[model samples]
Target chain A: MTTEHGAVKTGDVVARVEDLHVHFSVSRSAPVRAVDGVSLEVRRGETLGLVGESGSGKSTTGLALLRLVDATGGRVEVGGQDVTDWSRRRVRSLRRRVSMVFQDPAASLDPRLTVGASITEPLIVHDLAASRDARRSRVAELLEMVGLRADMADRRPHEMSGGQKQRVGIARALAGEPDLIVLDEPIASLDLSVQAQIMNLLRGLQEQLGLTYLFISHDLAAVEHMSDRVAVMYLGRIVETGTPEQIYRNPAHPYTAALLSAVPTADPEAERRRRRITLHGDVPSPVNPPSGCRFRTRCPAARDNCATTDPELYEVEPGHRAACLYAVEAVEEMRAGAATTP
Target chain B: MSEPVLSIENLSVSFSSRRGVARVVDGVDWEVHPGQTLAVVGESGSGKSMTVLAATGLSPRGAKVGGTVRLRGEDLGAMSEVERRRARGRHVGFVYQDPMTSLNPVMPVGRQVTEASEEHLGLRGDDARSRAVELLDMVGIPSPEQRVDNYPHQFSGGMRQRVVIAMALANDPELLIADEATTALDVTTQAQILELVESLQERLGTAVVWITHDLGVVAGIADQVAVMYGGRILEHGTVDHIFGSPGHPYTQALLAARPQPGVRADRLATIPGAPPVPHQLPPGCAFYPRCPVRGDERCRTEEPPLTEIAPGHRVRTFYRAPHSGIERPAS
Candidate 1:
């Protein structure tokens, strides 16, 4: 099925980001480079997962995509239109094409209004519907679309569960019929079972609506589950980008490998035999990041070249890219070790 | 295994408000022997933290707590209020998820940690200060002596949490209650804290009641696992039993819902309904509405008692494996 608005069909680029940079300036300190020279693309009908630590700039990249946060330098193209330095009116118009689902649905939702009113408010703001009855029916349809009961429209935000509130949030984002949806930590605050339900709902909604999602989260496994392509970010830079199989099994970058390796497996025997790469130090402040590579301080494969040269993301294999100078060598050793293990 | 370091029986906690009286924890019987870690896994409002709080006499105001909490054969519930307070730090150490709130921002990290040693062990002055430095060093805090003088805000988040762990270990208590200790930290920091706790547990042989929602961490660290649903223990057994061959339908669904690395599925397996709130819980099984394999009518009308499936494995339900075929035959 085609989306309500726009002609963005399957296999087309919904959002394109090139060398994007977002910096927060304080009076007495150096600018915090939250997102530094990162580039990615989200194709129509696909979920592109952006993953990193708290200060790794994944959220900032999502905000930049939605025009919620301003970019310092670079181009952001949403639905074949540039949104980097657009006027206020243009950005307001762009809002209809791209909507965002916030991390905490409870905090994002206005408790004073019922969920149905909350969902319908977007329709009125965007003038998507002609009349009140039409908007109410549209909200009901959206509630059912996210697997919520139609009777739940009258309940306040506090009356619903976390998963149900998130469904409302998804329904609100879908109200404008956005071609690209920036989902920021969608299922981070949910229970394991409810998280599964929400993830499944999200995937099913994407399939049904033909929506493209720039999914940003810190959860590696959940990101891998929802993403068609995964980008690993570290201290404001994209360290690696690849398909889930390439990123998870044969990670090229040391940061990516360490991030994946640190995840404690659920299988008891597998956890016992797993080789852990424990990164020693905390993430450095974004205000005064490292000179070249921000991850050099904690990277075990770091050498003299890391401090001097900021490596650009180079294609190590077909369609898989990494920014580490020792990407090939590090991944080769990991593969060799895995191959000889059994 | 050695004798049980901490034993709790028939523990239940309820809070009364204008809304109503809600029983948060219900009739839980658990024991942690020395050098054993019992992970209480549950989601929000599942009474995981309340179980530990009631045992330690830290329940909130207007809350009624009933149970017997024994520490090394001594009944803490029978003890006087002051005696219980003394038993808390000297015998039981508590670690919470948020370190910033646990530690005093204005006080030096040294004084906060040393305060435990001073009050519990009665070591004062230079002795307490030196012991604080040693505890900090034991928890892998670099430059222990210098950092000891620094306040909590001076340290990084991971460092502050390490200081909290240091303080938790200051008295070298036999039982440690860590409620989502690493939940607030980043993944890398979480790995470091887990390693620290594992090493400290090895050296100290502290019986730990580690409460968390992450199944992966439970598999990595705990010796035994207790799966809690609506403030009730749905299943309890060895980690191997819980992970390898789960018995309860709730436990089976939780394990399946979790997304693990290197495992892929077109869609995640999900329990269909939400967990019942404490106040609105049904008279029978709280998970019956969501249990895919619930086949028996008795599950909706009669509350299942905790029945032993193996020597140590127990499940609080009567849906035998073969009776239900929808999902893993009730398991």
Candidate 2:
């Protein structure tokens, strides 16, 4: 697990999940297998980006990591402690180790509370501050740390813009000084420029505080940029995991290739020449996912083998793995074919 | 080139409030030719939507709309309310971002679309129904005859959007206005929608005004691009010129801020402040406060007129800084 700057050591795992599953029984219908048998790890001081489209269980996985959603089956170990089925008392201790920045800042923060109150709420919950003054000053310090002015702390969430409310959300997430932070689509709804601001802030904070992040989003471009390691999820399963270069430059999975090609770039000439792999259908429902390989229905290179036997994640390169039979050769062929298409 | 399908001269939209009048779309001018797609790119509240709404007489009541909107040389501004509505329905079509809200939940998808065809195209009952099905099939909805009777909720997000596109194209107007139509869908689904629109435009020869904040989508389909900020277009150019050598600093920053798939940066090129509020926009250049390369007092004291910087490329700025990457800090 050698990284660019050697900031993340190979074995220093901050959080780990083993064969996790989260099922929901909605409207008395069949159980929805939102997160089905997924497992991954977040190394200390490195961001692991979880990306997928809607109903792919990326958000559910993020919630399960902090025990906000009960684990139907499997174990979640954070900071070397099993927290899968932690009691209320045990979960409180887990909260001190793990905090989350929700997708919608407006809904996450209490509308009635001031920004200062919201930022200090976590500190007071875990009793991290010795005194009210200590908590107050820490709130101010956090505001400054997230590049917000101290005076804005007195304003409520409605008084600020979306970007400012997100800043408050980050300040609150940092109040506990957790070892790991789970950011669930933090910039999905923000504008392009504001999204850039938040991404820059997240990167800077991770570097400065040595904090590990499990950044989850459907935005593939953002996930690629922010993640030290990228995990592509499809219908509640991790289809591929690798470094940005491996995932973006030489994607092993057909799904990853389709996603990369789907994202239209800012260069017009390149777009004109780009041969898009147009996936013809919507994401199949997770309740009744495809029988064998989940993406077999949409996978262009799917075969008879894909329908009966589920392929586990296989290593294609150092620190890179994909759960597809044609990941190695077909993807290379497709890449070469695309480059010379026009 | 053939006559422009839609042209607006000095178009502006303002709403009166207790505080004062909030001018959202301020003195905007643009033209969309038949069979060409013009992308209006902007952040939220940048008046991209308002410009189209006002030009097509869809803005909210009590809002003040100024300037002339001419579609096919017909003065839409001088038309009476009923005449304006008829002209808009017959000549212009609209598709919004969220298909669920724009579509009727209780109405069957078939009926919802045929209503537009019946009202605008004047096709009778059987004619409207069959035309609706054909339009749905054209938008790539499978088994359109069977699925036409299903409610909007029965359809998936992408299919619902396809239905919306069907509704937009049922009348086969000369112009189609899609405001953030594909922004809500997944990347793959967005690609499908973009391709669908491109093919439809090719077949029907309808002009398109695509309003979105995603430059990637702009690069993919737009013939010309307009970058909007603070309810005004800051830059306008052909897609090649805009992507190749963006003439404005804001345009440059917007391009730099996009997180490319293979590109990694420790810090994204940040534009420091949020877009100026409509009511509180600065007197001169609306983007001056957040501009990386500051223009002199001329930019501060007076608004810069749109100046042609290249063939078919215009920039609204006094500063002629190099179109370098968005690394220089916001002034």
Candidate 3:
């Protein structure tokens, strides 16, 4: 259940989820398995990118770490402390160690509050600042840290651009000085030009503060760029996990390969010659997912065994693992093919 | 050369509000011939969508449209409302970003697909249903005969999009306008939709005007690329020309900004500022504020005209071309 690969010596674990599950009960039917048996680790000062489509439970897993949603099963540990059984009042104190930045900055930030007030609220809530002047000074520092002008504190959310609003959201998140920050699709709404600015800012912040991030997004390219390690989620399960180089270069899982193949490159020449592995149909409903393998219904390499036996995270390399029965075979064949090619 | 399927000449669209008159699409000109896919790439408020909307006579209320839009060499502006509607029904098809909004939840998917055919092709009852089944099958829907009766809610997002695409193709329009059609779907689903559209275009020879902010999608599916900013096309050329040697700095910056899946960079290149607001646009180039390689005084004072640098490739810039070191000033 721990899913700690033997050779993954990536420093101390800042945050982790072991066999976590979150279910939402509907009226007359079974509960929706939003996050079913997902286990992951965020190493100290390193980013772990979670990539998936809508309803893949990537968000739910992140929420479980923050205790925003109650876990139905398994354990969630933050800073090496198991907090899965913690109550709401107890979880309030946990805010100092773990925080979240949501996707829509417009929706997250209050319209009535100034940028300074919004960031200051966190400082006051956590009792990080003693006086009003201290809170103001801290707010200014946070603003400058996120590449925004200190004068921006006086402005409201509507006065700022999408990228600027997101920066404020980041500033608010950093006010608590948390060890782990869950960035849920932080740059999805920004323009192409602005997205890069935010991504660079996040990377710089992570390095300067030695922070750990559980970056969740549907954008594969952004994930590969920002993350030290990548995890592919499918139907509320972590299907594969590896370093970006290992996963992007040579993926073991059929779902991972298909996802990678589907992302079109910016270079037209490369795109023209590329062979895409298109998956058929759509992601299965989470209410009643496929019996054995969640992805077998749409996977190209799925066989008879895939439909009967639930696959575990099979080791493909020292630090790379995939939840597919034939992943080991696929990885070996891929390496062989690579060796034979020029 | 064959005649263009759709053509717009110096088209400008403006909306007057309490604040001021904002020119959303300013003197834009583009032509899409049969079997050609022209991608209009830009960020929000870049007017890529407005250009097509105004050209197709589908601009929102209170919009003041100027210049000429021709469909199959016939002037759309000169036509009456009914005539324009008839022309649009017969010639143009659209697919928006969200399939759910495009489709009605209560109606059967078959009736929706058959609506266009019945209205335009004069098909009735059994004939219309049969045509809907064919369209669904063509769009790669399995068991199209049975799935045709399913409502929009019954199908998944990807399948619902397929149904919408089938609806768009019901009339076999000569021109297809897909505005961010794959933006809402996942990458895998997006790939499937892109492939379906490509294959359908090959068989039907329908011209496509794909409007999206994603340069990667543009690079993959486009024959021609037009990079729009501040309601004006900063760069326009064939995909090879645009991707290989982007003449404009904005185009260059956008390409650098995207994080390529396989390629790793220490830090992604960033554009300094936000996009220009339409009503408060600068006196000079719209991108002048954020232009990393702006030229002397002229680039900050005078707007650059669209100048032809090579055959079929035009760029609007005052400075020398990016990477080429060739000075092709606005003329």
Candidate 4:
């Protein structure tokens, strides 16, 4: 699936995963099926938001693509090249095509290293810059791209604020000039006001550099704003996939609907008027997930069929799919209900 | 309105640090009536938590606490240390962000729940056990009698929070303080907890002080909101007033900065510059550096008082806030 000269044309699939699985073996216990039979496609120059709660395996799926975690089964293709079974040594070249921005920037960066060195390390490792002077200039350019001052290059991680550290992290990720970036909860640690700043910088950088993003965050509102399309993950599977409009407006899966309804809008009037669906019981242990449907234990719309049969992704509309037996009916009912509402 | 369940006046908390005196909660004043919920909203270091800590007599060691805190019309400042501690357990209850930290890991859930009842209500043995089960059942914990024996680790994150809530209500305190109680749970679980708290509040008529950084949560749960910045209350008003007709630049910027559930925009409205540190706070308005609307030079040199712009609404800024049809009365 390698493109000519590693050049992925616009609208091409920059990264694709087919039935990917990442399982960790826990001693004296059942293996944790972190990423079980997941499939996704991230297109060139588009941000695909991965929205999920904790223990949903979204981060594991992202790590699987970067070969940080080994895929126990299935295939992963990044930049049109299959890296599913690639060793750590062979995976180094793949890093040049894909990079990651972690949730905590302070943890991701070295406290001792200057911001410039942190950004330049990737360039040196990837051999993107030929000389030391070239690396220095490239580091400055990368910092400027992330809305940080060139003078910030000399500052240490502890010397900067949370937002500034995140900017440095983004600069380091951009240093590799990767075709795709997996932003795993990039703005989760920053303050509310600073979150907007980092988000805007990311969007601007994406537009300027034509970088594809796999934006992973638990914040549903943020995912809706940034993604052209969104995939809702529950337990270890992608339960729903659609454009932000379709997914947020008319969620086909019950889990998606419950998650959406749970988020209170910033407006008081709307929040008070909105109908909230409270799920009974907590999420089942991932080690021993509920039979058939993983969300059946807590789903408000669960039926006998949900407990008996494992559902697969079924198309509720063009480019919109949900892994529920009642997807088609649910979508139709929601749409009809919405149309009738005053 | 009936008498306030908890009233704080000119509450100030400062710690003597190596760098300087860090005035964390500076002259905060508010009141919460019975069955009312006041959300103290702010980012980290904004002193929302410090204000609550000082009011509850839980301020850290070597910290100076000034002003009066009245619980159920009794002044806390005048009470002795032992009296204040006893009053805190009987009149006020707390639930923090992490349930693990609040609950005793080694103790049975029922034992932890019964401790408050035993100490505050003088319920002993069977009476305490029955009360524990009853409280747990009220919090929607299924099979309360059986689950009461379980330890904190046995229950899930959401269920643990439920147990914590049950314990908080064990003493039947008139005031409850939940500081980011549901922030750690999943959205579905958070919804369940929020519903549980709301229902409990309704049934028990407990006034609640909800301290959080999430504006959306504030909109859903709060009757009144106090926006804090750099250890000062920039704005205090009803939820409608704060969200619909903000009278402070900081409040307006925060409302605009947050990404609403349904609205999608190319770029979010942002407040430039970082929030101020407590020690280095400027003498003028705390939000002046990041405020989008700075009216005049006076705002940079003098701290404006919290002046009422409307009945039950106040803004601490020299800039004339756009009040629409309602005119600001001269202060």
Candidate 5:
């Protein structure tokens, strides 16, 4: 490691995961490793984007952090305190400091409850505000903070548009004054114009409140636009971790490179000129992921060693790391080679 | 080109809701030539889905459909419900957004495919089952014989989509309407699906009308692109023409809105506000409120018709006229 840990140490760490593993019983002899042996940290006032394909353990890792799902093995530390084996009462207390925004806002919000009630329920549950007047004032403030009219809060979830509902969900997550929020594909369901609005809202709120976010998504472009740092996940493991610029411009892992290329470019001329690194085969079952590097099956640079020995995440550049032996060597080779062609 | 495999002219679809009479699709004109992909690109509720749904006579009850839809020179507007139903499966295939909903959850994958084949082609028993397996194999589903018996829930998302494709191709219709087919899939699976659609179109010579909001999906696959905004075709032209020399401000804004990978632009050029609803559309240009180049007073009062900008490219915008101050690039 390059010891850029010093830079990360300067900031207050809001959430940290140590060797988290979440497994589900698939059959009598098999267990699906939804999230296996993952370790990460989210700093206060920072956005950590979790990028991955479906069945890649990205969502499971987010859920594990919130204790929404049972963790098979792991230590979840929020605000420098370990809540790994907390009592039910302690867990409820910890939830006040942390909140989560689900993928589909329409599905997440209670259809029967009005938007105002849905948002204020968290405040009531956490006992953050005692009086009805206090709760109502807080709800109105949250709605205004998320760029929604306070008057519309009386409407039910079905009455509002998709973007409006998502804003309400964000308002609900913010009600508890959380230090960290887990956003799982928050803007995936919204249209492009609405997605931009949500992204801007989230960015503005982060700056204003100094809140941390564990942003999970499959869209690389959106991830790059929002996150300060990103961790690429595959088969329940963090395959690569780097800043947004590093991940997009100089991808160290083959899977990351392929994923970056897979996102379609808006510039037609550039789109035609760029060569996409199309991967073969579908994502393998989490129950029986391939040995060693789980992405080796679809990795274009996979070698014989990739099948036997699992690569440890090593720093290819300052603060940029990848779990691929070949990636490190490839980076060295590219460094040695001259600027021969465009 | 020869007569289009599917031609829709002046098509208007209206629905009587409790609110009022909502004109979802208004005076739309579109065509699909054999082996060509015509992409109908628009945001949700822009009438893209309703327009196509009306074309196959599959609109919901009480939906009023007008204008002429000619498939192989036969008028679909004049056809009876029963005749339209028979013509739909035999001559036109439809692929919905959610394959899980389109495919039966209880029925086996093979049986579902065979049902479409048997219903449209009258193949029965062993022949239908054999054709179903062949269709599965054609769609690149592995182990067609054993995997065919698996239920919809048993298959993965991509595999389930493949099964849906097989069912769509069972009748081998001349025209295929894929409404947001790859929207639910991931990037890699989406690329595969697009490639499959392209290769199959080449082999079968079937014209495809792909409806989606994702510009990337239409980038390489579509031969012709029709940009719809506020229930109107704002721009229609060859893919290269639209991508390189867009005429309408709405189309330009859409192109600028999408963020490209590896390109770190400071801010995305966004057209603020959502598309207006069918009943609440503004006078003249429905996009005037969000149009970046809205200047002339006529744009606020006079509705522009689809005027030819090039040999093939057409745009419905008063801002792109001869002396409208917006210079047209040499075609």
Candidate 6:
């Protein structure tokens, strides 16, 4: 597929994953493939939504990007430098350029440390700020940037609300002045209104700081609003990649279609009119994924070919790509049929 | 019209915080008829949970509750602690968000379910055990007898939730309070849990109070809905009325804020500002700060009481006009 809107140029790639694979050894026989041969890029000043259900390697991918979990194979390049083989000291230096905001803010933030100290510690550890005075000033500035009051710095994580603590987490992630931020469900714990505020703050910060984001989330709607481009993952591989409009309006992958259909429409009349595609059965165990195409089990349009041959991601439209053999023809036919029906 | 199975009127709950008396739930009113699901929708700290929590006398210590919670024409608030305890597990059952936390980790699933029945219904040993296995099977847990002996840790997230539901229904309570029961489950499991709940409601004719923040989940399950903000009910109406013709700005913003799958907007109409803290609520409409349709002095100075808009729909907006053609009662 050719580069579309917000597609990262080779030079603009802030973080690049090349054939990354992460596997965990569980006994002597075989290993659980948490992330398998995933390749994607986070561009400067762009949000790439990495979306999937549980056990789809979304979290593992984020972890692999940060090198928190060692990838069994392939390379991770940050800012044109291959950090995949970096030492502890080198990795620590690299951490200053890449930071992560966890899904659960309450669990991520230290209970013993005050919010101020937590944010400032990152600055001090990374040597981003010169002195105590500088670190404090940076912490306060970051907090204010995230719309948190300066006085809240002294409070513990438990004392603050879920949204407030999440803001603190964002502030801490920003303390090192990282060019790339891996946001794993940053607003999942917050309320709808609060989520909006946080998302707006994130977008504003990205604009002001030129931050690159690898945004991972299960909430497709939030992802659509936040992401410039999206990668849909099933099991441990990227099944489709496209712009939000392309994915939402003309999803080629059947799993993508079912996921989009499952989201409830706010408009009652529209909801009644729309046909919801329900995928039967839960996600298969990642420990033992299905043969050939992993999505074949739940895919509505699955054929005998899908069970024997894994389809590579092929361009269905100008820039939209899907990893299913029949997706291109089927999607085109469906669109044409819809146009004629109306 | 038939009387509601559960009616909560003029409900107020105050917690004695170190700062001062914080009104967690203030002047909330709600009703649920037999076989109907009433979803109390709100964000965290919106008092939706506290309102229902107070009804069952389940509020933490040092919290003072003042309200009339009438269940089947009986005032639950008037009862003593012992009486309320007996009434709670017997007539009113509660399901929490994290099933793992609610169910005992060490105890077998069968023992847990039987414990509820034994305590509330006075069923003993073999009888309670038999009933427990039956309840498990009813909730769609396969091989109830064998699975019942398994610990909570052995069950999947969805199965754990099913175990919780089985325990909740052990006494066959008339009113079931599900406090974000399906929040922790995946979408597919959520669908199954909701289907189970709906089917159970049909079979038992039990009134359900589902408290959640996910508008999508509520749309699937709720027959009636109440949108709460800043410890107050901002809008209360039938599901069709609330979703189709939202009267309050908060409710409208909530509906608009949700990102549906296919709907693409330039930007989601997100209401700015977080929900106000309990101690720091604005004097006027609790939602005035974030309300898109802000009126003049009235919305900022004096609080608006929940006024009827139609036969069953009510809204707490001083602005009499409904934004989307829903009729409002004359002041």
Better of 4 and 5 by lDDT: 4
Please give the range of 10 consecutive residues that has the lowest summed lDDT in model 6 chain B.
B320-329
Cα lDDT of model 6 overall?
Answer: 0.83
User: Which candidate model has the greater TM-score, 5 or 6?
Assistant: 5
Name the candidate, 3 or 5, with the larger TM-score value: 3
- Of candidates 6 and 4, the better by DockQ: 4
In model 3, which residue pairs have backbone atoms overlapping below 3 Å?
none
Error of 6 at B109 (Å): 2.3
How would you encode candidate 6's per-residue C-alpha lDDT over B76-179 as one tens digit per residue? 87778788788787887788999988888999999998797788778998897889889999999988989978999888788899999999888888989999
Writing each residue's lDDT as its tens digit, candidate 1 over B44-112 gives 889999999998889988889998989898999889999989988798888899998899989999999
Cα lDDT of model 6 by residue, A1-342, tens digit: 222233446888888887788999987968888888788888888899999888889999998877899889988889999989898888998888889999889999999999998998888787788877887888788889998888889999988878888899999898888989999999888888878777877888888888889899988888898898899998899989998999988898877877776676554445445455555566877778898899988776678988999877877876688888888565454444434542
DockQ order of candidates, top first:
2, 3, 1, 4, 5, 6
Candidate 1 lDDT for residue A271:
72
Worst 10 residues of 4 chain B by lDDT: B321-330
Model 5, residue pairs in steric clash: none
Tens-place lDDT digits, model 4, residues B1-331: 8999999999998988799999898999999999999999999899999899999999989889999999999999889999998999988889999999999999999989989878877999888888888988999999999998999999999999999998888888999999999888888888888888888899899999999999889989999999999999999999999987888878887877877666788899898878888998988988888878877788899999999999999989999555431223455
Question: What's the TM for chain B in candidate 1?
Answer: 0.95
Model 2: lDDT of residue A220: 84
Give per-residue CA lDDT, model 2, range A114-179, as digits (tens). Answer: 999999889888998999889888999999999999988799999898999998999998988999
Q: Which wins on TM-score, candidate 3 or candidate 6?
A: 3
Accuracy of chain B in candidate 2 (TM-score): 0.96
Question: What's chain A's TM-score in each predicted model?
Answer: 0.93, 0.94, 0.95, 0.93, 0.93, 0.93
- Candidate 3 lDDT over residue span B69-135, tens digit each: 9999999999999999999998899999999999999999999998977888899999988898999
> By the DockQ metric, which is better: model 2 or model 6?
2
For lDDT, the strongest prediction is 3
Each candidate: what lDDT?
A: 0.86, 0.88, 0.90, 0.88, 0.84, 0.83
Candidate number with greatest DockQ: 2
Query: Could you tell me how far off, in angstroms, the CA of residue B242 lies in candidate 2 after the best superposition?
Result: 1.2
Model 5 chain B poorest 10 in a row by lDDT: B320-329
